[model samples]
Target: MKFRLLLSLFIFSIQHLISQTIDKEKLLEYYESQRYADAAQYLQSMYPSDTKDTKSLTQMAYCYMMSGKLPEAEKSYLKVNSIEPENVPVLFSLATINSRRGNKAKARAYLSEIIRLDSLNFNAWKQLAGYGENADERLKYLKKANTLNNTDPDVAYDLSMTYRELKQYPQAYEVLKTAIAADPGNFTLQQAQLPVANQLGKYREVVENGEKLLKENTDANVINEMGQAYFYLKDYQRCAALFKTLEDLGVRNEGTLYFMALSYRELKEYDKAEIYAKKTIDEGISNHTSIYYTALGGIYEQKEQFSNALEAYKRGLTFSSSPTLYYRLGLLYDFNLKQAKNAVNYYNLYLKNKPDPEEKDQIEYAKARIAALTTTKELVKK
Candidate 1:
């Protein structure tokens, strides 16, 4: 009778244990239905302790993450990590959470661990590139990522930009070209190709690629690049037309104004050229102010407005003692204004400043003029 009673008790205990056990499929059904909160609750009730159930713990972490319970998600992920220390997905999740939380150091540590376990992890290398301490480190990681996955447009773009930033123009151009070939309609890669081509002195390529971009989208940046390409090609009319569009669009910065002024000047529209050149000066891009003033002076010289030309050149001198400006002043004073003394002074100033190698001919001419002017002055004094 005692043995039968014990057997009945054991059978009841087994039935109770089976009833209390949670079905993973039921939890998955809740998760798959987008009932993440319900799944989390069910998992919590079933696995109340930090059990060795990595799958359940990972699902719970995902649920916490999807529900915006980041702290809880992090705790659950850590629990999974404790159980499966070399788990790449868990490590990557922890890295993502730390990155989103602005914990860069911790995120980097996690990514480093991932790479240590699986060196071919492209995503881990790409993520690490963002957290690099310097440009060289970033470049290193990006290059590795690119080697692993050259087909990704984002990876190609990033690697190309890194090379461009380091002034490795040829590499940038090559990478961008390969990326464009793979994804021909990628506007970003096409646009990026323009500047690198320009840097490589491939102005014709800029025009070709830039025109292609313009056909698809009338982006202001694409228009500006096309205009620059035209300017370099000496297609002043086309350059001026494109720049006018930019001006009409209210995108008239100092660069656009300078290009517009130069284009008009090349086309001999002196009045319009002077207007844009002076506008460039008013825009206060100090680095190019000297060039604007010089262009304005050249326009006045073309119109034979000698006094205006002189004033413009003098204003330019205040900003930059450019040898070319000095030479222009010497020519204006000597030939047009008939100020031999001032001409001699300017010619002397031009010689004193080290002129560019391309100005060798101009330097020789100045020397001859100075000698003649000084002789004339001596005879006049006598």
Candidate 2:
């Protein structure tokens, strides 16, 4: 029995070698002659069990992918990756397909891992560098790639992000100056260079290009960014005026309203601040409405209207499922309204949301209040 088992394994190994060594010329003929179905059928019969035949698997995956058998193709690629985790070609192919299939996060994860494994992979660096939220990390990778291969303009452009992210104004300005020299009037480089300068607190850069942006691009982003630069330079009146201009010019988005209210708050124009805060809600900007709600509640609290403040906080709770609202409401009830039951209710709600490691003690205190409220209620019923 042992001899038979060993003999069977030997035969299988030989047959697998035979399958893998099948003539490349024949396979190419089958593929080029549009015999995908026949080629697949023959390949499957020859290697009934999956094996580490990279070329054969790649061909089969391509056929499967082209035939719209995406699952089969994906499985084949997974088998390839299992066999060779560090195969740049396999990883790149898989990443490209994942990206095309709209699995951006999955694509990003794969590309990021590949870059981590092989930093000199310029394709991976270039593709991932375009991700807006991850521009900083991507730029780091790109700089490494540029150090490896200096002639690539994409590498230079990508590495320019360090200036923006690190707020290295002069270095960014100098690098961007050189990049623009290399590729004068390239739209992306031109667009990115100014922000790097702005971040570095180069107000002169803003002043120099601000007029050009306003004249050439009436884009809301351009306008908002210019307004922000002015705001940072302590030009509060101009900031408020620009925000008001944006609002008047049909740029009255939530961001515009939020900035306008902030500008007003900074300018000590509390009436205008309240007006914009209320308008932000009226415009149905629900995501950041909590901040505005807290602002309005704070205003009411300052005016000594505890009832209105509490109601505003409660309204904020409805708009946002934020724990901060409940926490503030709890504090208001506990300290100002002298309503322990309401305080307990809000505290419990806050506790439900407060799971941060630093907030464990606060969470415990809130839970105790809730438990106390339950006990008191039971005693009253009795």
Top candidate on lDDT is 1
Candidate 1 whole-model C-alpha lDDT, 0 to 1: 0.86
Candidate 2 local distance difference test against the native: 0.72
Model 1: per-residue Cα lDDT over 1-382, one tens digit each = 6754553453344333333666645654675577877877776776657466777688779888888777888999999999889999999999999988999999999999999999999999999999999878988998999889786788888888899889999988888888888889899998988888888889898898888888898989888888998999999999999999999998889899999999999999999999999999877547677788899999999999989999999999888888989999999988998888888899999999998878889999999999998889542653
**206-310 in candidate 2: lDDT tens per residue?**
755766766766666666767777777878778778888888888787767877788889999999999998888777656788878988998999999998998
lDDT of 2 at 234: 76
lDDT of each: 0.86, 0.72
**Which TM-score value belongs to model 1?**
0.68
Instruction: Name the runs in model 1 displaced over 4 angstroms.
Output: 1-29, 285-382
For each candidate in turn, the TM-score is 0.68, 0.47
